[model samples]
Target chain A: MDSSASPLSHPFDNAIRLTGSNGHYQGQTTAPYANMVGPFGGVLAGVMLKAVLQHPQCQGEPVALTVNFLAPVADGDFTVDAKAVRTNRSTQHWYVELSQQGQVALTATAVFATRRETWSAPQTPYPGAPRSESVPAMPKVPGLPGFFANYDLRLVRGGIAPMPQAEARLPHCSDTLLWARDNPPRPLDFPALAALSDIFFPRLFVRRQGPALIGTVSMNIIFHADANTLARQGEQYLLGEARAHRFYNGYFDQSAELWSSDGELLVTTNQVVYYKE
Target chain B: MDSSASPLSHPFDNAIRLTGSNGHYQGQTTAPYANMVGPFGGVLAGVMLKAVLQHPQCQGEPVALTVNFLAPVADGDFTVDAKAVRTNRSTQHWYVELSQQGQVALTATAVFATRRETWSAPQTPYPGAPRSESVPAMPKVPGLPGFFANYDLRLVRGGIAPMPQAEARLPHCSDTLLWARDNPPRPLDFPALAALSDIFFPRLFVRRQGPALIGTVSMNIIFHADANTLARQGEQYLLGEARAHRFYNGYFDQSAELWSSDGELLVTTNQVVYYKE
Candidate 1:
């Protein structure tokens, strides 16, 4: 079957569906993408971008997006207001806010530009990994967050299983390498890529080998590939590598790179999360 | 001499100086920190943060800052309007805009939070580097930008000097390791660190072995240290290590980590630049 031509509607599409026009739209949380305390942040990010994409004044494709999670988003309808603050010759700037119950829940800024042919190369080499078919798919645990079921994740290294008592006592390195794609095999798109950028579990959970109170404060994703490049990826798995640089005081920041199966870098993202120990 | 206690004011302070209140202020570009086109982006970022830091309603220290360079900031006076869009219990969200002649020149969003004691560790090992005292300072060339004269830079590797024609034909790696601090030895502060985070030259210059028409479209800086930690680094050189992840089409993105002389990770920054080849 051609995954790109699948007739069934993808859950991702339904979760980010919006109604209304003229820079203001209404959306609601869907169960399939619910997180522990709110809708998955990646989904919210997608919604924010969608707001601008749907705007009549928006120009060019997304080059950079910064999302700030101001407060917990309740499980219900939310409104997104997207304004094109400035539109230049080649690039356009935007400010988007998601509000629930008349309260600001999240805010984001995005840059979109028209691309032209130019000198291009990748400096970061793709990490070696076995073919996706050879790796076992991550099993669906009964109690995991609903959003985990939406993606087919195959771990290459640094899985989040609890560490042995002795290993947990020592300072541990935090890194994750995995092969991932939307489950049920949906075709790759910008919104899906935006959502996938946030798929990595919090570094606190990955390093401590246990649960803790954590929330993402801000996330920035830079898209390197245009529409044509992403379409070429189809439903193929992308290799994702993520690692934390430091965990200090009550905050930690992590960086991740997503690469196409054919070795093209698709996106680079950095995010800071707040944690309580 | 006690550098921290130097009676003379620093150029950074004068560059970011503002007058006014109630989430609105006026500022101007100073000659000392001028770049090729407009003022140095780092100094503008510092000014944006200062607008918020000086706001009476601001709650905590800055944890994340995202600056979007929309258009060239012409020399002269500009207005900065910073609004605390939302102030939560532990974190505050800010929206700042810099405009000249009634046109928006730049827009930035920042998150500030009240930090508390928590488990802390550094996962990414610091790169080896010679002591700041052991390396000779970078000499000021006649044609360099004015901003270059304000910082004492000691290159450990990956200087931007042109390569031989034969070597330039092949693809080259882009990375820079250097030690840098204010030239006049001013004490460290949040705004100063914000300005320092953008000290790395465009990766295009380092990789292509020559100059290109390039400008930073967006930059994000995440602070890992607080005021107390910055105070401890007064007038001290920071080891800056930066590298490009990928250069695609007309745009490229790079990531950088700024570490203190004692090997503590002080800041992590990422940016996307537009290039005309």
Candidate 2:
């Protein structure tokens, strides 16, 4: 899929496509979006939202989504069952599950709300990160998650691994500032933003060196921008800031923010990760 | 129902009790826990979690739970259907829905994890809020939600309402700090903490004067302490701090921290709320 391709024909759309019958949908895992264990968590999260949005009974736009990665998903065929459990005049609630080998691998809940004009304010100050041109692009490492090749990441700070073998120091804080845009340069949408929510590396890796058995236990994301805001920023780099507060007893939680280059708060996300050192 | 009663006999237990046969459970709203238009969100959240905990197939302790308030629940008999969508040796995923009159009113997904000893640290420092003994307890105001009597709240700051028509100024920040405990002194546990997650008043009320139609759209809570920690803090007041980062276009989000009286981090919670003026 070329970066210049149309949104309807993008690989991301193809990767998350599902054929539905009787409220159950089926999709196949694509090589480009595979993670070390299975499909990328971000992609999976996006696919779950897609499942909900594509449902015939779906309403409004996504405002909140929570995804629980119960187990590792193997690359192959998968099934998603999304149900709009409740529909209100202004909001809708959905429950979605992804299953492989007839066992559930992921479970998620989402709230979609119809937006209206009202008093508004954003209290989180923009990171004011350096422009994308000021930061060097991350060198793609071989043998990493297959999905790595699908993102173009430029590090502004806290670039720990894949170092040039010099100037390596233990990160003073588990904070990362970067600029990221999907590789085929897809337009900003719920699914794209959902996938981008998990774009940051594990906070452990950001703070310490070396690998560990790490998996995201749960992730919650709230979309702060509307469809117009996202559509206007299509294929452009979005500033991302991520930091962790606690790492304890095999688990740690982190918070992140994604902002449009012009300073719009696109999304706020948080997740808890499990690590075995 | 007495504060000094054993955990088994506490009113919190009675409030969340469900009678089930073959995985479906039925519960009714208790007057003591009714909110403005329905039961308290925290109580509803607790009951949803209770459904999972009481499930015969429940696997481990809860680590994360996300609840979506789909609609305004009416006071009456409601049914909860809890499904163990997936179970591994170490963790289980569950999806639950609370329905009334055959309409879904609330939906939630929870992740329960088996714990193991490992490296541990809490990065967020203790807030060191003033002792409960020093702060004046909130006066029970007439015409408030019936559930207001369920908790004993002591305010250290951000006490905007219930004033005696003096010492009231526009709040400068949407931050609240106080000591809170179950009025009936129920022992600390997952359900109690879940209920406490929504204990704070809407930030809109905290930041501005007057009333507005406010509803919690979605809430996510991550449990930071183990069962032992909660058990040891039994029936003790916990320090709570809540603040918001944004209030935009008919919605706003706030994050909160719950700490034991002695400074142990217990739970971190975040929620997005809907408002109309």
Considering the two chains of model 2, state its CAPRI-style docking category. Answer: medium
Please provide TM-scores computed only on chain A for all of the candidate models, following their numbering: 0.93, 0.93
TM-score of chain B of 1: 0.93
What candidate 1 gets wrong by more than 4 Å, as runs, is A1-8, A162-171, B1-8, B162-171
DockQ of 1: 0.82
Model 2 C-alpha lDDT per residue in residues B10-66, reported as the tens digit of each score? 667767888886559998887788888988999999999999998999987888899
**Which tens-of-lDDT digit does each residue in A1-277 have in candidate 2?**
2223245576778777888765699887877888878888999999899999888888888889999998888867889999877788988888888998888888889988888999877666788976888777788765568797889898887665664321233334777788999987888889989999999888887677556789998999988877888999989999998877678788888888899989888888889888898
TM-score (all chains, Cα) for each model? 0.95, 0.92
Per residue, candidate 1 scores C-alpha lDDT tens digits across B222-274 of 99999988888988999998888888889999799999889999999999999
For model 2, the stretches where C-alpha displacement exceeds 4 angstroms are A1-8, A163-172, B1-8, B162-172
Best by TM-score: 1
Q: lDDT (CA) for every model shown?
A: 0.88, 0.83
Question: Which digits, one per residue and each the tens of the lDDT, describe model 1 over residues A1-277?
Answer: 1122223678888888888899999888887888999899999999999999989998889999999999999887889999998999999999999999888999999999999988898898888688988878887654568998899998777666632121322358678888999987888888899999999878887787777889999999999899999989999999998899999999999899999999899999999999998
